[model samples]
Target chain A: MALPHAIMTALLEDDMSGYELAKAFDVSVGLFWRSSHQQIYQELHKLADRGWLQCATVAQAGKPDKILYTLTEEGRDAMAEWVLGESRVQEGKDDLYVKLYNLSEDNANHLTAEISRRREHMMQRLYLYEKIRRRHYANPVSLPVRRKGVFLALLAGIRQGEQFLAWCDEALAMLGTIDEPVE
Target chain B: MALPHAIMTALLEDDMSGYELAKAFDVSVGLFWRSSHQQIYQELHKLADRGWLQCATVAQAGKPDKILYTLTEEGRDAMAEWVLGESRVQEGKDDLYVKLYNLSEDNANHLTAEISRRREHMMQRLYLYEKIRRRHYANPVSLPVRRKGVFLALLAGIRQGEQFLAWCDEALAMLGTIDEPVE
Candidate 1:
C-alpha cells in the first residue's frame, strides 16, 4: 500500500542500505507509519523486482557487502502521481476507545490505571515533538517552502498529544469521584 | 482482530440482525473502528461458530426470516477480559502526511486542494460530534456509571475532531502564502 510509496520517498531524499533505512524508519517514517524491518526488507526486494528501485552493492572491509537502494526515474514519477492524486480520509482504529465504550463499573480501577499509563506515554511524545519544533521550526512565519509541510505535520502531532493528555486528566478526575463498592 | 471485540461490544448493548448491525456500525461503532458490511457479516458467522454468539431466526411480516445475533455468556466474559487487559497504543497511518512529506513545488496547488477537501470533512464530523454531545451528554457530570464511559469516549472524539480542524486551518493559512512558479 502506502509503505512502498513511503519507502520511495525516503530513498528520494537519500539512498541508503537496508540497515540504515530500517533505522530511519524507526525514528521518522515510523511516527506516521509503523513497519517492521522484515516487512521493509521484503518491500525493498519487491520494489527492485518491479523496476521501481535500483540497488548498488557497496563492499565493506571484512564484512558482507551492503546493498544501497535508490529511487529510479519510474519511482520518482510514481511518487509525483501519488502526491497529486485524491486521498481518502484516514480512519484510525483505536482499541482503547472500544474498551472505554464498553467499560463497566467493575472495571473502573483498571480503566483509570490505563488512562494514567497512556497519559505518561503522551507526555513523553509531546516533549519530543516540542523539542523537534523548537529545533527545526523555531520561526514558523519564515519557514522555507519545502519545510512548511513538515512543520505542519509536526504541529498536528503535538496538538494531538496535548488533546490526549487533557482527556486523560478529565477522565481521571471523573473516575476519582465515583465510589467503588467494597468487595 | 479488534473487529470481533467491537462486534461483541455492539451486540452486548442490543441484539440486532446482520442488516441492522451493519447500519448501526456506520453511525456508531464506525467512529472508532471501521468495518465493511461484508467483513462484518463474515465475522458474524465466525463468531457464531466459535459459540461466542447465538443467532435466532425471527419471522417478519411480508418478508423472509432474519437471523438476529446475541452475545452469549462466554462472549460477555471474553469482552470483560479484553476490557481489563493492557492495550497497545494505536498507530494511525495517514497517507496524506506521506504525500505532504514528499510534495515538490510543482504539486503545491494539488496539495492545497487536498487540504481544503480534508478540512471540509473534518468540519462535518466536528458538527456531528457536537450535536451528539449536546443531545446525549448534555449533563455528563450527572451521568450513570455505564453512560459515563461512553460520554468520555465521545468527549475524546469531539476534542480530536476539533484539533484536526484547527490544524487544517493552520495548514491552509501557511499554504496560501507560498507562490507557485508559473509553468
Candidate 2:
C-alpha cells in the first residue's frame, strides 16, 4: 500500500507536524504498519505535491518553522476510497521461518541456538508490553474514555509474548530429550 | 541488519534452496523479521561468490536444475558471531501505526471504516491459525518424541495470530465509540 494513503488518512483526523505523526504511529496503528522518518518526510512531500494534503508553515521560537499538515478535500475523498477498498487479510512478509524450512540434515545444536535466541527475544517483548501497560494505568487518557480497545490490544501483545516464552520452555525440554541419544 | 547475515545464519542450522527459505520465512520468523524472495536469491549468489556458501546443482528429470546451498566454515563463523551479538530491540516501523498516529484530525466515519477493515483482517488471521492447528492435531508428525520443538513453534504462531485478532476487536469497539461522539 502507498504510504501516502495511510498518511493522508491520519491527517484527516487532525493536523500534525511530521515529528508528531511519527510518534503517534508508534502508539496506535503501528501494530500493523510502519515507516521510517525519512520515508514519512518523503511521503509528506508527495502527498502535498499531489494536492492530497495541505501544509501550512507555522513559525516557532528557537526551532525551525514547522510545517503543519492537514488533509484536503481531495485527500479525504482519496482516503475514504482507499478505506473502502481495504482487504481482509494482511499477509506478513517474514524471514526467520525460511531458515527453519530448509532443514537439510538435522543439527540439534543449531536448533537449540535458534530456540534460545527466540526465548530471549520474547522476554524482551514481555518487558516492553508491561511497561506500556503500566504507563497506561498510571496516566489514563482523559480523551478516548472508552479505551478498552487500546487496553485489550496491549494485553494481547503482552499475552502473546508470554505465550511464546512458555512455548520456548516446552521446546527446550523437548530438545533436551532429543539431544540424549540412545546407546 | 543484512539479509545475507540472516540467511547465512539459517543455513548454519541446515542447508536449503532459495524457494524453501522463502516459504519457511513466511511460517516462522515472519513474526519478527521480513525478507523478499529477490533479496534471498541475491544473498545466495553473493554468499556463494564469497566462498561462504557452496551450491550443489541438482539434476531433475523434467524440471530446471535447482541449486542446494550448504554453509562453508566462514559462513558458520559469521553466523556464530551474529548469534552471539546483542539483539536489538524490535522497533515499531509499521505503516499502519504511522497512519493512526496522524488520525486524530480525520473524519471519524472514515477512521471507523478503516478500523472495520482491520477487524475483518484479524478474523481472517484467526481462521488461518485454526486451520493450521487442525492440520497438526489431525496428523501429528512421526518424528521422534524430541521433535516437538518444531510443533511448539507452530503452536506459538497460532496463539500470536489469535492475540492480534483479539486486539483488533478492542480497536474496533474504540473506533465505534468515536464515530458517534456524545454532544
Q: Best by DockQ, which number?
A: 1
Kindly report which residue stretches of model 1 are placed more than 4 angstroms away from their true locations once superposed. Answer: A61-64
What tens digits encode model 2's per-residue C-alpha lDDT throughout B48-125?
Answer: 999989999887899888789999998877665554444443443343433343334234455556666776765775
- Tell me the lDDT of candidate 2: 0.62
Instruction: Give Cα-based local distance difference scores for all models.
Output: 0.85, 0.62
lDDT of 2 by residue, A1-183 (tens): 746765664565679899888877655454445677788898999988999888999999999998999889988777655543443344443333333333222444566677788778778767766887787744434445324434544555676677667767765665665543444
Candidate 1 residue-wise lDDT, B1-183, digit = tens: 589998988887799988899888765767889888899999999999999999999999998889999999999998899898989888768988877777557887898899889988888887888888888899998988867887888888888988888888888888888888877
Q: Where does candidate 2 stray beyond 4 Å? A: A30-32, A88-183, B5-36, B91-152, B165-183
TM-score of each: 0.96, 0.63
lDDT minimum window of 10 residues, candidate 2 chain A:
A96-105
- Highest lDDT, which number? 1
